[model samples]
Target: MTVISTGVYPIDKLLNGGIEKDIITSFYGPAASGKTNIAIISSYNISRTGKKVIYIDTEGGFSFERLKQISKEDFDNVMKNILIYKPVSFLEQRKSIFLAYDYIKNNSNSIGLLVIDSISMLYRLEKGDEDVNEVNTELARQLQVFSEINRKYNIPVIVTNQVYSLLDQRDKIGIVGGDLIKYWSKCLIELKVYENGVREAILKRHRYLPEGLSIKFKIINDGIIEYKE
Candidate 1:
């Protein structure tokens, strides 16, 4: 099946058996909203199949300790199938994506998923120094590469994004890259923080699922699980 379970029951169910392949799936929210946790858990799940997961960490949020905790005794084996690339700049992020594409093509059938954990971090950093239009164009170009990879390789591209409050609408949250990210992502999930370590994931957009459906989950040391009151 192209759909892979995210290891979180509620999220898997919400995604109709899990994240779909050959498209972009985005998770975005405020800081500490469990965005990175979801990405890590998804990577762990994909690695369990003995398939490589190309993880591009733009925010240095990829955690080996968290993966070990989630994998338990299978940590060593799971780690083998996950390839990580840390890019410190937006330009490097672009290069990493290209390298990832080449690596996947050469390996052939070895990779199952591609993840850019907080894909917007480096771009966010570059926004102030670079021309607004130029930076936006570059960001869109990066996403276009992923889109091409998605279509050509039939691999799922998962990205996490940082959120910003809208200027006129202070209550509403918008993702970095705005329409560009939305255009590429077939599934969009908004994470919300509640009391304690609890968080909510709302299915904001999807190909088949109904929108506005939400599930509360908690990030424990081992992994994420459905939260209950």
Candidate 2:
């Protein structure tokens, strides 16, 4: 299976070379934990290889300025290859996935990665009005569609998730989608911000990687970089 590098050395090492193709890799963390940076860097790196990337932004967090900072002279070319979708609501997000899947089906040879920046944002917003079971079922169905796309097209899917602190379990954080995400994701990574602005990525679960393995990295103006010291 082909793997796409995240464009960060230590992160790629933690992922056992790189993110495996045809699987869903999830990153969950609080604000400023480097989730978006990883997604952007990965998209930029994959696009650099002359392949197209499908980026779905649920939180309005897609930053062209940041992309320009990372891609430098290749900004325009990279943007050309990336087909971005900004879904304003939960329904739109689902529709966007279907549209992306269809696009990939037609252009499988050219598409390399599928990125959903903050997959759970819209879900969280709509959760209060919907039944819990109904929400979960819909979420499962959406993820299943993504899995099918990955398995059939051999495209790597990267999704970012929000984290919430549990009152009883102060030290252990819970991901927004709860157990469903944990069960469906092929690889799960947890990001944490430490003292002195240090950022760390913990490889919580993977098909091949040993649990509890981690790596340290920093988000700079250019992109994600391994810690110097």
Candidate 3:
């Protein structure tokens, strides 16, 4: 598939027919803004097609309950196609990414998507003790591997990032990796909680699409839908 639906109609349309193949798409946001939810739905969307989805979970964000809610009848089959890895530390995270690459390289035709939900969780934790520059460089190296996989195997990579309050800019929030993440991600979307518990996805950067395009949606139990109210 050239592109895979996020399983949310408005989001799919906003993304010009869903997340594109052979590129890295990033969804960054504050807590409870649907980043992980989108990741889960996207994995299911691809796995349902009989393709393998390599999901590297750094924040313990993968929920069996939620996957069951989304997959429903095909839960067993879809679950089998999704290979999930939960890395406890930054080093473990790097190892997991390498393992994912190896699996994809060996089973190139079967892999559909690679997701690192909250990719920066362990990075953030280690930043304080380790040299900031080294941490950033390691992050860059990890992303470079993903980029190579995209070009080599032609599978989509989706990663989630946490936000931090910008220093001296209280009202603003910036993604964890900032420019590095933006530079690597071919498509970038910012998720934000909007009025009455709805969420908005703002297209920050894309190769063809104009920036600042957005859509509003709500996260329901089964999946997400365009908000009507």
Candidate 4:
């Protein structure tokens, strides 16, 4: 496993360098919790490094205005290097998996990184309610396809997941996919939104971390700027 720099100082340090390549690193959190910001920034950095990135946007989470935050330099090639595809419906989103898969399969030399803005949209839309049977049947098949791509391509896949509401009234917050999503994801990152303008990201499930360790961050108009404060 190759750990590449996330480009965030404290975050990189926390991951013992960065997230490993050739696997899926899923980041899950609520709406407007800076999840999309990090995705755009990460994609920018990866693409800037001469990697042909395929970004699949599900919830209109990607933006060039946000990309300028990481690097103010001319983004003529960076933006072009990234092939963004927006899938309007749930079925359309699922089809993009194979579309991206085929593109990479044929144009092996052109692909370097792949990102799905939100995986939750597929699961939620398909199974609007807590239908475990539907998820296990359809969701399992969906993840299996991507999992194959992750292992086969040897290129890193960054998937942004959506957080869900907990059934109980406890203080515990959770992501959308019950055990299936949790089990399928190789890396799990949780972002916390505090009342005092403090955003903290926890490296919950990772081979490099000591179970549950976290690093602080803040969200600005630019995006999720890492500030250790």
Choose the strongest candidate by lDDT: 3
Q: How displaced is residue 108 in candidate 4, in Å?
A: 3.0
Ranking of candidates on lDDT, top first: 3, 2, 1, 4
Instruction: Flag the better candidate by lDDT, 1 or 4.
Output: 1
Q: Which window of ten consecutive residues has the lowest lDDT sum in model 1?
A: 1-10
Q: Candidates' lDDT values, in order?
A: 0.89, 0.90, 0.92, 0.76
- lDDT string for model 1 (1-229, tens) is 4787877777897788898888899999999998888889889898998889999999889888888899999999999999999999989998999899888788858888899998899999999888989999989888998888888888889999999998899689889889999998999999999898889999999987899998999888878888978
Better of 1 and 2 by lDDT: 2
lDDT of 4 at 97: 78
Per-candidate TM-scores read: 0.96, 0.97, 0.97, 0.90
What's model 2's lDDT at 98?
91
RMSD of each: 1.3, 1.0, 1.2, 2.2
Q: Candidate 1's error at 225, in angstroms?
A: 0.9
Instruction: List ranges where model 1 is wrong by over 4 Å.
Output: none
Better of 1 and 3 by TM-score: 3
Q: In candidate 1, residue 224 scores what lDDT?
A: 81
The TM-score that candidate 4 achieves is 0.90
lDDT score, candidate 4, position 48 = 81
Better candidate number, 1 or 2, judged by TM-score: 2
lDDT of 4 by residue, 1-229 (tens): 6877766655676678877876678888877666787777777777788878888998887877778756667477788789888997667877887798888888767677788889778667767665768665776676777778778877778888887667785767777766777777888888778876777778878865685888887776544556655
Pairs that collide in candidate 1 are none
